[model samples]
Target chain A: MKLRIYALAYLLFLYAPIILLPLFAFNDATIIAFPLAGFTTEWFSELTQNKALHEAVKNSLFIALMTAIFSTLLGICAARAGAMANFPGKRGIIGFVMLPLVLPEIIVAVSLLVILRQVLGVNLSNWTIIAAHVLICTPFCIAILNGAFQNLDPSMEEAALDLGESRWSAFRLVTLPLVMPGIISSMLIAFTISLDEFIIAFFLTGTNPTMPVYIWGLLRFPASLPVVMALGTLLVALSIILLTLAEILRRRGIKRAGGTDKGGFL
Target chain B: MGLLSAPFTYAILLLAVPLLAIVLFSFWTQDFMDVNTTFTMDNYREIAEKPIYFSLLQRSLYVSICVTIVTVVLAFPVAYFVSFKVHPSRKSLWLFLITIPFWTSYLIRVFLWKVILGYNGVINSGLINLGIIEEPLTFILYNVNAVIITLAHAFAPFAILPIFVALEKIDRSLLEASQDLGESKLMTFLRVTLPLSMPGLVAAVLIVFIPTIGDYVTPELMGGAGGKLIANMIQVQFLQLNNAPLGAAIAIVAMLSVTAISLLFVFLNRRWLRGRS
Candidate 1:
C-alpha cells in the first residue's frame, strides 16, 4: 500500500511541472505566482505575433526534418551492415559509433565548436547543428533499426536473390519494405530528439537560432517569462504526441517482425 | 566491401577527429592572432596551480554523486512497484507515462524548477498562503540543494528505466524458492532481488552520474554564485574568457576523472557483491 502511494507520488512529481506549464500559460497572469487569475488565450495568441519566435520555430523544424532524414539514412546503412556483415572489428566499430550516445553533449558541443571555428575554419550554421544532431541521433536510429533488421529472415532475402533479383534490387524490394515501419519510427524519434536538443544547437548556432536557443535567449528578459511558458506548454504537448506516436510505431514494427518486446528506451 | 565499411569510416572521421582536436588544443597555446601549434604543458600546469578549478571540480563530483544516490534510491521503489505490483498489461503504459517528461525540453524542465523553488516561487508562495511560515524559505533555491533536486528530477526517468528493466529481468522462480525456504519478504528481497538487479543499478548510476557531473545548464540556471560547477568554469574559459587551452584541459581532466571514478565504483560494487555471497 505504501509502495503504491509512493509510485503515485513519483508520477505526480514527474508530471506536475509539465502540467503547471499549461496551467500558468492559460492563467492570464504575467507574474508566475499563484491565485486564480482567470483563464485567457492571450499568451497563445501572442505567440503568433513574435516574428523572431516564428523564425526560430521555422529554423528548428527545418533542422529537425533534415536531421531525421540524414540520420535515418545513415542509420539504415549502419544497421543493415551490422545485421548482415561479419567484418573484422565489427563489434568495436559499432561500439565506437555508439559512443556519442553516452558522451557528454557539452563536451561534444565544445569539441565541435573548436574544430569548426579554429581548425576546420567552417562557419557555424544549420548544417553544423545537423551534423552534430546526426552524430547523436544515429545511435538511437541504429538501435531501433537493428531490431528491425535482426528480426528479418536471411532466407527471405536469399530467396529474392535466387529468384533472379540483383543484390541491390533484393534489398530494395524485400528488405526495405519490411523495415519501412521501423524507418518511419526512426525518423520520428530522430526528429523529436533534434527538435528538443539545446546544448549542441546553442553552441553551433550562427546568425539564426533554433527554438530552444531562442528560448534560452528569452530567459534573460524577465518580462518574457509568461510568453516562454506559453511556448513551453505548446512544445510539451507536441513532444508528448510525437513521442507517443514514435513509441507506438516502434512497438508495431517489433510486432510485425515477430520479435519479443524487450522494452524500448521510452 | 568498401561501401559496406563506409559508415564506420564516417564515424571515425566525424567523432574521432574532433576529440583529437580538443586533446591537441589542450597542449597548444593560443595568442591574439591564432592558436599556436607549438605544444606545451602550461594548460595542465595552470589547472594544477589554480585552486578554483580544482575546488569546483570537487564540488561537481560531490553534487553529481548526491544526485546519483538520491535519484537511484528514489527510483528503486517506483521501479519495484511497476515491476512487481503493476499488472503486466499496464507496465508499458506506466513506462510510457514515465518517459513523457523525458521527451519535453530539458531546458524547460530545468527552468520550471527555478519557478518552483525560487524565492517567491511556487513552494514559498504556497507555504505563505498556508500560513506554514512567515517568511519564504530562501535556502531551497540558488544553492547546491536546488541543483540536486532539479537534476534528480530531470534524471528520474533515466534512473527508473534501467532499474525497471533490471527488475523485470529477474527470474521469478528464484524469488519463490527463497520465500519457500522460510525467508522473510525483506530477506528474500535483499538476497535475491537486490543482487540480481545490480547490473541495471550500475547502469543507472553511470547514466546519471557521468552526465550530471558535466551538466552546465542546470548549474548555470539554478545554481547561483555559490553553486557554480566545473562545467560552468569550462564554459567561461571557452566562451567568455577566450581561454580554449584551459577549457580543453579542464574538459579532458573532467572526463578522465569521471572515467576513473566510475571504474572504481564498479570495482567496489563487485567486491561488495562478492563479499555478500
Candidate 2:
C-alpha cells in the first residue's frame, strides 16, 4: 500500500545515518566510500588500543554521570517547588528556567565560555563542561520531572503528613517512590544530552575532548574515517539504548500513575 | 528552607550570573590588556555598517525558512499517516523511529552527509560511474545547498514530532462527520485537518526556525564561504577576532530578529486559529 511505503521512507529518513554508521565502521578500508574493501574487525579493534580515545571516553563518561545526577537532583527540587509550594513569581521563575531550551545554544555556549574564561578566570577542564551541561540539562530534567510531579496525588502527601511524618519524610516515602521512574528517565535523558552535545564541549574543553568533539577533530583527517565511524557506531548504539530505556521508564511511570500529559520529551 | 535554598542558590549563582554577565559583556569594549568598562555603541554600529552582515543574516533566515517549509510539507503527510492511518499500537513505534536520530551525536549525522556528498564520496562516485557528470561536483559538499540539506536532515524530526502531537489531539469523530457530510478526502484534510493542526505547525516552525538560524556547526562544516551565516560571524568576533562586544552585538541582533520572526508567525497563526474557532 502507499501508506506502507510512506511509513517505510519516513523511518528510513530518520534512521539511515544510524544504520550507515556501523556498516562502514565494519568495512575494512579506511576510505568511507561505497564498495566496501572487505569485511574486517580492525576498526573496532583499533578503538580498544587508542589510549587518547579511551581517556576521552572516560572523561566524557565521568562528566555525563555527574551532569545527570546533579541536574536530576536540581530538577527534583525545582519541580517539587513549582508543583507543591505556593511561591511568588512562580510562572516567571519557570519561564526563566526554561529559557535555555529556546535560547540559541551557540549563544549559551559563547556566553558560558566568556564567563568561565574571561570573567571568572577559571581553568577549563571536565568541570567546565559539566557546569555547561548542567545549565542546559537541568531545564530538560525539570520539564520532564514537572510532568511526574503534576501527575501525583497531593492527597497522598497530605495523608502521610497526618500520620506523623515530616514534609521531607512524606516526600521521600510517598511522593519519591511514585516519581522514581520519572526521575530515572530524567537522568537517562540528561546523560544522553550531555554525552552527545558538541558546541559547549568544543568551547569549554581545554585538553580533554568529549566524544563528539573528538569526532569533529577526526573529520579533518581523511584516514580517520573508519575510526570515526567505529566510534559513531558505538555512540549510536549507546544513545539508542539510553533513549529506549528512558521511554520505557516514562511509559511505566505513566501506566503506574494511570495518567497522561503533554511534554514528555523536550 | 536552607536545604531548598541550595539548588536555587546554585542555579542562580552558576546559571543566572553567567547569563547576565553575557549581556553586560556585550556593552564593554575590548582593550589590548583586557576588556574595558566603558559602554559604547561601536559594536552595534559596526554590525550595522557591514552589508555582508545583513546579507549573511538574510541568507541564514532564508535557509531556515526554506528548511521549515520543506519539513512542514514533508512532515504533514507522515504525521497524518502516523496519527490517523496507523493503528494506535503502531503509533509509538513510528514516534520512536522518528526520534531515535536525536539520541545520536549531531556531529556524526553531519559527518555522514560529508561522506554522502563528498567529491569522491558515495553519491558523487555513483554519479561519476554512471557518467552523469564528467567531473565530481564540489557544490554538493561545501555550499549553501549542503548546509540546507544537512540542517533539514537534522531538524526534520523536530518538525515532525510537534505536528504529530497536534494531529493526535484531534477528535476522530470530526473527520467521520466530514465524511458523513460527503466531503472528499483532500477537501476534508484542507477544511478540517489542516486548520486543527495550525498550533503544531507554528510550533514546528519555532522548533526548526529558531535553532537553524543560530546554528554555527552546519554552516561551518557544510557551508564554505557560500554558507557562512551570522552565527559564524558572531563566532569569529568572539573567538578568533577577540571582539566580544561586536560578537555580542551581532548575537543580540540575531536573537532579536529570530524573536521577531517567531512572534510574527505566532501572531498570524493565532489570528488564523481564532478565525477558525
Candidate 2: tens digits of C-alpha lDDT, residues A121-233: 99999999998888889888987787778778889889999999998899899988888988999999999999999877887897888777787888889898889898888
Best prediction by lDDT: 1
Candidate 1 Cα errors over 4 Å, as ranges: A85-88, B1-6
DockQ of each: 0.61, 0.53
lDDT, each prediction: 0.88, 0.82
What are the runs in model 2 whose C-alpha is more than 4 Å off? A85-88, A260-264, B1-16, B126-138, B275-277
Winning model by TM-score: 1
TM-score of 2: 0.93
User: Pairs clashing in candidate 2?
Assistant: none
Question: Candidate 1 on A159-230: residue-level lDDT in tens?
Answer: 999999999999999988888888998998899999999978988998999999999998888788888889
Q: Model 1, B60-84: lDDT tens per residue? A: 9999899999999999999999999
Docking class of 1: medium
